[model samples]
Target: MTSSADAPRSGPVSAWAPLAIPAFRVLWFAQLGSNIGTWMQTVGAQWYLVDA
Candidate 1:
């Protein structure tokens, strides 16, 4: 008896599956913004310490 997980997929796994869902898209963008903000703060802090 084969379990569903052992079955071969019909095609290549979709890379866009997450974007197809609205909630996932929202969360993805939110995290992206958060990462950008964090990195900017990190770089600014490093520069300040190095210059001072």
Candidate 2:
């Protein structure tokens, strides 16, 4: 099998870009912002867990 060094770089690293079309940009941004907010909440929970 080929090693990680042989991985293709020509394509996108994520499939998220297709949702960036003008009609979808607003909804996409809203969803992404909410996701980031949820991420922050999870991080806070982890921090508290580690501290305790």
Highest lDDT against the true fold, candidate? 1
Candidate 1 Cα misplacement greater than 4 A, ranges: 1-9
All predictions: root-mean-square deviation over Cα? 5.6, 12.1
Collision pairs in model 1:
none
Per-residue CA lDDT of model 2 for 1-52, tens digit only, reads 9988697778656777667577798888899999999999999999999999
Alpha-carbon lDDT, every model = 0.94, 0.86
- Predicted structure 2: lDDT: 0.86
Count: clashes, candidate 2: 0
lDDT of 1 by residue, 1-52 (tens): 9999799889777898779889999999999999999999999999999999
TM-score of each: 0.76, 0.54
- In candidate 2, how many Å is residue 21 off? 5.0
